[model samples]
Target: MHMKFIGLLLAATLLLRCQPSSSVDPITTGPEPEPYRIVRDSIKTGTYLGIAIDEQAASVYPKIQALQATKGVSALNVVSNVFADLIALKERLPLYQYILLDQKSGTDSGVQITVEGKTVKSIYLNSGQQLTQWPEKQAVDSSVRVGDAISTLYDKLVAIRNIDRYTNKFEYISLMTKNLSADYDGGMSQSPQWYFGFSTGPNQMDQIQVHFRGGKVSKLYIDHYSKY
Candidate 1:
């Protein structure tokens, strides 16, 4: 009986030894990197496309006239000569009900400006479109204009760490490619590190997205928001 008991005890001890340990090593990993920033507040005041928020239509007309002459391949037939004419006449005559800058023609890509009391109210620049032959200046910073290269934009802006925070490294590397073929059509630069802000409404924020098309900045414009 004693010998049998000893054998059973040894077998039980072996079984226990074969079981996994109840205590486990904690998983070890590095801290997650910070996410890419985005402009959170509305931007109310700034100059865009050479026009200020409250600038009179008459004061900005001459500049518009000049810009009309420089219409690029994207803007042709989109904004008719009547646009300049209406602005010219609307200064003295009430020929139109309201002045709205919209791109009904073309690829439905362009800047849309809303005017109230003959003053520019809101502006939304779509990176999907390029309207003028000459690059338009950013309202906040004229030094940073549309149609520039992504490399150029990085050089002009302040030091911004973790540019790929919003996107993975592989995707960011693809965007930084030079003059990507037209067959490769889509690109975006939404890292708040790259955007400029504007005050659009109370508690609302706006941003100028430095959008890229074919590896060049196609447009830079304030996204006027109404959110409070």
Candidate 2:
């Protein structure tokens, strides 16, 4: 009886040992990584990249008119800064890019922004000046919509301007559609094709068309009054 009992105990001990000992080994994996451009606060986030792209092919008409009246060097369109002085951009010039400044000529419409020395930003204008072209809300198409129309307009505008000297850019035939038309109000600049004139006053329309197709905006137009 004692021998039988010992054998049974040994069997039970072996069975217990054979059972999978899983108290679940603790996982040592680390947490997942963060995204490229995530911003916690909705209001504090930036669209700097979007703004920069938009500025690439933007129209200087609205700002130029404002500057034309003031005859000032800088405005919503034209910006001049020192080669290294980013602090001078007092107010964040939203949707503007650096235009390479020309070392020699004080003004070269050929170049958007330029300075004798190198600029911290990619774009530059002549004489260390910079210009950021905002969308001509007035210039947007009223009929067709969808896709990236504003950027399209901006692309076409810059392509043309870049192809020719600054003088030619003012005259370069715009590929953009004149799908929507506003009667020439006449505060127009003497510059070529820039015939339409508008008040240098604040843009009253909540949103202006940036790009157009089939008589409508190509990209989503932000209705500043309403969240898009």
Candidate 3:
């Protein structure tokens, strides 16, 4: 009887050891996050009419000259010497402005390229009084450009997750378009300039304006201090 009991106990111990174990997986680390996704995915820079931001003045001048020669586009260079502030005047920081006229009455209705200290500062492209004209609505970047429908730009802007706080808000204002050519009698009409203001902190706001001509984007205005 004693031997049988010992045999039964040994058999039960062996059966318990043979049973499958309930597994508990070890802790694992997740994949690393990409730090540059926001910047990489965001619309940060713009290219206007073969000119880009931060391009050397020497190189850009030649291209502008070529455009003038080939396209019959008038180019004018002016230096801004007047400043309301005394310090600014004393500094003698002159802005080298290269204007591309659209055969309109005034330089205001033209593409203005501003450079400070041999660096291209800002680019403002707008259609002249004709509802369509020179500067030929070019790309601001791969994703956005002049001549694109305003709705398309809006859609692209809304889809950007970065800078949502600022990009989401927009203001629309009318820009005056006038043709001085005897037919129109210098008559002025209204076109829309959509403004989108972005701010990262107090006292500083970066702005972008999309000016429309004939219901399409004819102007792309980028601020020098803009991040987008």
Candidate 4:
């Protein structure tokens, strides 16, 4: 009986030794990383396209003028017509992946821009409001189709609005793609634009329009309705 008891004790001791140590540090994991972008707590009182125009225009617009001159275009015309495009395409301009607009009143707005090297590829504008007016509904062309861009935009909206906290406050409406006019004549074959709509309240919906050029978002429009 003593010999049997000794063998059992040895086996139990070996089993304990083979078991994982309770003191061993656990391997911890975190959420996926987000893209880099400039975020400001408040939008400057006097700013244009999220930049302080008074401080930046003199130094920045001049370079844009030079580029316009190369194309035999007048600075005034370019400034009036394609200033945003010029700023986005300019290599010298600072590149940003996202910009968060947090107002002093505690309201938050955000803009996400996708960039490839020095070129601005796409832009996403999110205003925390539900949309009521939809002027572009008639312009939608069902022939154009959107791929994963809609899904990406949906995920982005959820992240921006903290929709998980509201629990069924918003409902997915539709995702559509359309060919939009890029110029006055509508001659240029611009990339198809994606429109994602969501119903935020009873009989109220918000729409986000994303325009892509060369597989990159060239423009983003957020038509939101005030919750109040």
Q: Return the top candidate by lDDT.
A: 3
RMSD per candidate (Å) reads 28.7, 29.4, 30.8, 25.6
Question: Which stretches of candidate 1 lie above 4 Å from their native place?
Answer: 1-193
TM-score of each: 0.17, 0.16, 0.19, 0.18
The TM-score between candidate 2 and the true structure equals 0.16
lDDT of 1 by residue, 79-148 (tens): 1112222223322221111112222331222332322233333333333342322124323232223333
Q: Which parts of model 3 have CA positions greater than 4 angstroms off?
A: 1-44, 79-228
Instruction: Give every collision pair in model 3.
Output: 47-140
Whole-model lDDT per candidate: 0.27, 0.24, 0.28, 0.26
Q: What ranking emerges by lDDT with the best candidate at the front?
A: 3, 1, 4, 2
Model 3 lDDT per residue over 145-220, tens place: 3244333432332332133332212111111111111122111112233222233232223333334444434545
* Clash count for each candidate, listed in order shown: 11, 36, 1, 4
What C-alpha lDDT, on a 0 to 100 scale, does residue 46 get in candidate 2? 29
TM-score, prediction 1:
0.17
Clash list (residue pairs), candidate 4:
37-98, 122-217, 130-225, 131-225
